[model samples]
Target: MTKPLPLALFGHPSMARRAWPLALIVALHIGFFLLLRDGLLNRIVPELPSTIVTAIIFPPAEPPARPVAASPAPKPPGPAVRTIIKPRPAVRRTPPVVMPPDAAPVSAAPAPSPIAELPPAAAPAPAVPPQPAARPVHRATVTSGVQYVRPPRPDYPAQSKRIGEEGRVVLRVLVNEKGEAERVEIQTSSGHARLDEAAREAVQHAQFRPHMEDGEPVTVFAIVPITFRLDQ
Candidate 1:
């Protein structure tokens, strides 16, 4: 049980002291090296290279077009719509009437006239008398019973005398109230127009005594005959 004595590792106290310095230096160097290794692992970690695949994208091809259907025919135009305009009624405007200030008023019944109603009516005029109608004059034929103031003397036509036309012509002569021959007509033809015309002309220029009825002269028809003789 005595106090223990110190053991010498380096075989000397001085050697041990010097060995402690060397150990400290080695510890410091190991610590610095471990720190550098940790820093290099954090800064430079290897990453795998990514594959560079360049994909080319082309648009898909368009589908084929379908055929178009035919269009329908256009509809026909409808009848036109007409807009009728009615005329407005006319207005009649009459002007107001104005009467004159100085016009005289008319009475319903007029006053009676005393002068027209005072006198009596005149007596009716006397009735007139009627006269009788006159009678119609009588007529007769006097072939040879009448007297002649100037007898008819016919001159034979030169052409008839040359042709030897001979015939007798009877004439109906009208004798007037003045005892003169008014009209002459051929009662019987002479077989020749020239002979008959000559006899009619001669009788027209002659005068006759008028027929008598109760001693008064009257109008009558007288027949006269003329002869054209080729020997005379």
Candidate 2:
């Protein structure tokens, strides 16, 4: 006779106003199941030092490869030292003093010539002015007298006379023992890059005349050609 609990139905005010919205929906589902079992549920994560998290995610194991020392066995060749060179005892030559025919005529005054230690005269080397002979560089494929005193007035490239672009250009000139044009080499190329660069700028501004043979001024390689004759 003592089991009448259900709060005795709140003493029945219509069964406590119908159990008060099922006791406020069972106390709001037991306070949201104890606030989701005490915030977000079942999470005991504070124990991470598994050996400092396996020493920061596993990297401590490479110390075992130091054993390579076996190289000392090569000493078996010691028996070849026989140097006995001793054959120099035959130089005793002193037997020619038979001067008894007078021996008194040895005062000719020429015995004082031993003062001849002459090795100090080396200062006359400034007279080296005789080197004028290396002037024969002859590659003149018959360059007549190698004449052109600045005759390369090439300005004809009005795009090579409006593209007529003629031919000749030979050039290989290097003619320079002071007669200038010391280098201009396109031996025969006037198929026309503006008549071969206007005959290589008229043999590099041509001033030749240095290719003589017995009259001296040498350094030749001439072979000049250069026509480009669009009728001129």
Candidate 3:
């Protein structure tokens, strides 16, 4: 071994010893940085050459579309067929025959002569007849049961206050030989009890002439339509 060097710096032994270790660490770090830089550049730079960057281009577009062809017009229908109709044969007519004229002349026959006149004789006198006088005649008279007939009374409620305010009431009645109403029935309603009742009362008290048949008083069945109407 070489003679041991003096480990003193400016008379400081601790400073000299610290300086060597620090220098050795700084040298190792510098060497590692240079080696990393060289390796990274060598790998990446070779693949990335100096190439020109250009945008992609597309194919040219087709021209604008043309109009579609139209269908052909339909042909006209064929001409209509002609029909010839034959006429019927005419009827045959015969001409009338003419007769020849007569050659001889025609003559008329003569009339007979008149007779001679004679003298007149005397006539007798005519008898006169008397005319009879005309007799007096009597004519028969016809009468109707309706001439003296009266209407029947109406059967309605007595408590009803409204009188002729309602409509008319019609009643059908039959008359007997005694000139009295044999039967009475309402033919129609007056739409009010009072008016109907009043009509019935009147019909009950009504008088009538007896109906006659074959020159004698007889009971007659007749339809008497009595109307109960308001005065107004």
Segments in model 1 whose C-alpha atoms lie over 4 Å from true places: 1-132
Provide TM-scores for the models: 0.47, 0.20, 0.30
Deviating ranges (above 4 Å) for candidate 2:
1-137, 140-151, 159-161, 164-170, 174-186, 193-201, 209-216, 222-232
Better of 2 and 3 by TM-score: 3
- Which prediction has the highest lDDT against the true structure? 1
Ranking by TM-score: 1, 3, 2
Model 2, residue pairs in steric clash: none
- Per-residue C-alpha lDDT of model 3 across residues 1-232, encoded as one tens digit per residue: 2233366543577776777677677777887788777796576557656789999999899999999899898999999998988898897888875545764544666666666656566566576676676633322222234655554445444354343264676666566668787666677877766676677677767777776666867665545444544343
Q: Which pairs of residues collide in candidate 1? A: none
Name the 10 consecutive residues with the lowest summed lDDT in model 3: 135-144
What's the best-to-worst order under lDDT?
1, 2, 3
Per-residue accuracy of model 1 over 1-232 as CA lDDT, tens digit each? 2232344656877777777778678777887788677886456665667999999999998998998898999999999999999998888888976668887765579767677556777899998887677758777788677798888889999999998899999888888998888889899998999999999999988888778889999899998989999887
- lDDT at 123, model 2: 78
RMSD of every candidate to native, in Å, equals: 32.4, 27.1, 21.5
Model 1 vs. true fold: TM: 0.47
What C-alpha lDDT values do all the predictions have? 0.84, 0.72, 0.62
